[model samples]
Target chain A: NAGVTQTPKFQVLKTGQSMTLQCAQDMNHNSMYWYRQDPGMGLRLIYYSASEGTTDKGEVPNGYNVSRSTTEDFPLRLLSAAPSQTSVYFCASSERLTVYGYTFGSGTRLTVV
Target chain B: DQQVKQNSPSLSVQEGRISILNCDYTNSMFDYFLWYKKYPAEGPTFLISISSIKDKNEDGRFTVFLNKSAKHLSLHIVPSQPGDSAVYFCAASDTMNYGGSQGNLIFGKGTKLSVKP
Candidate 1:
């Protein structure tokens, strides 16, 4: 099973452009999260979905939005790209909040120029 | 403010020696702690974890020790191997303030561990 897979492994975007980073997990986990890792910084949560049809803002949700229409997919959209958003984005899923650990996807490296 | 911190940006250790990575947290509400290992161009993977109820947890050559009083934790890798080279992140989870929201994890700046052979 592809534990977690992210589309568009790498991308380069001009400022003001928009894009969506696709994330999917086959583990049927109830929790899904979007996080961005900047150089010298820890991974910060951008958004997360507790379950299908439910989404919530995280520590760094500004300039980004997310949707969880189905249990297997949780996608993150950048409305208007900015250079500050250029970072490695990682998608993760977990069975539960407290007991299980997250299974993260190979990150998407986005460069907003 | 950064609630979780990994002061050391990097560490190098000889093969067959112990590699100790440290993490400290300022939040007392954190009840769970975890360590993740990440390779280049890849996402972080869970390594080991310890609950607040326990002071120490061990798995194979990796052990996690928590000091509740000091709000500090450490991950120890014994007889380190070259393959153990990677960045290590320390994370903690605390309950959401209101609305029954699931707890969120706060991570520390990772420490790059290089195990020389």
Candidate 2:
């Protein structure tokens, strides 16, 4: 089974453009997170959902929005793509309060010009 | 301020040798630490971990050592192999504060490890 799956593995967008990165998990994890990996920056959390219909901001929540409409799906939306937003995005999920670590998606490479 | 830090940006070791990757964290509340390895275009995968209560944990050829007093942790790979070449990241979580449910991890800038054949 696909633990976690992310779509549009690669995308390039012009500044001010908008797009959504989709994430789905078959593990039925109640918590999902969006993170951006940049050179020398590690992974910075953008947004996260503890469960369906609940979302919270992380370290870098600006310029992004997230919704957990279902236990299996949590999509990250880029309102206005900026050059600063160009980075590799990862989606991860885990059971609520699980310390076993998160299962991450392969990743989506987004470039904002 | 960055809570987790991997001072070395990259490390190189020969096959059949030992590879040690170091990590430091500033937050004293971080009790659980983990290591993840990643290849190009792929997501990071959990490698090993250590808790504050333990000084060391081992699994096969890989071992993780945690020095809570120093706020430092390290991953040791003995008899390194070419297949071990990848970026290694050190992550920490405050199970006390964030709880097991939140599980918000703080990651360090990764150290790219290369093993020469």
Question: DockQ, per-model, please?
Answer: 0.62, 0.59
Top candidate on DockQ is 1
Question: Model 2, residue A13: what's the lDDT?
Answer: 99
Instruction: Give the per-residue lDDT digits (tens) of candidate 2, residues A17-86.
Output: 9999999999889988899999999998898888899998888999999888799999999999999999
Off by over 4 Å in 2: B99-103
- Would you estimate the TM-scores of all the predictions? 0.96, 0.96
What are the TM values for chain B, all candidates? 0.94, 0.95
Per-residue alpha-carbon lDDT of candidate 1 for residues B84-117, written as tens digits (9 for 90 to 100):
9999999988754311343588899999999999
Pull out the clashing pairs in model 1. Answer: none
For model 1, residues A62-106, the per-residue Cα lDDT tens digits are: 999999999999999999999999999999999865435799999
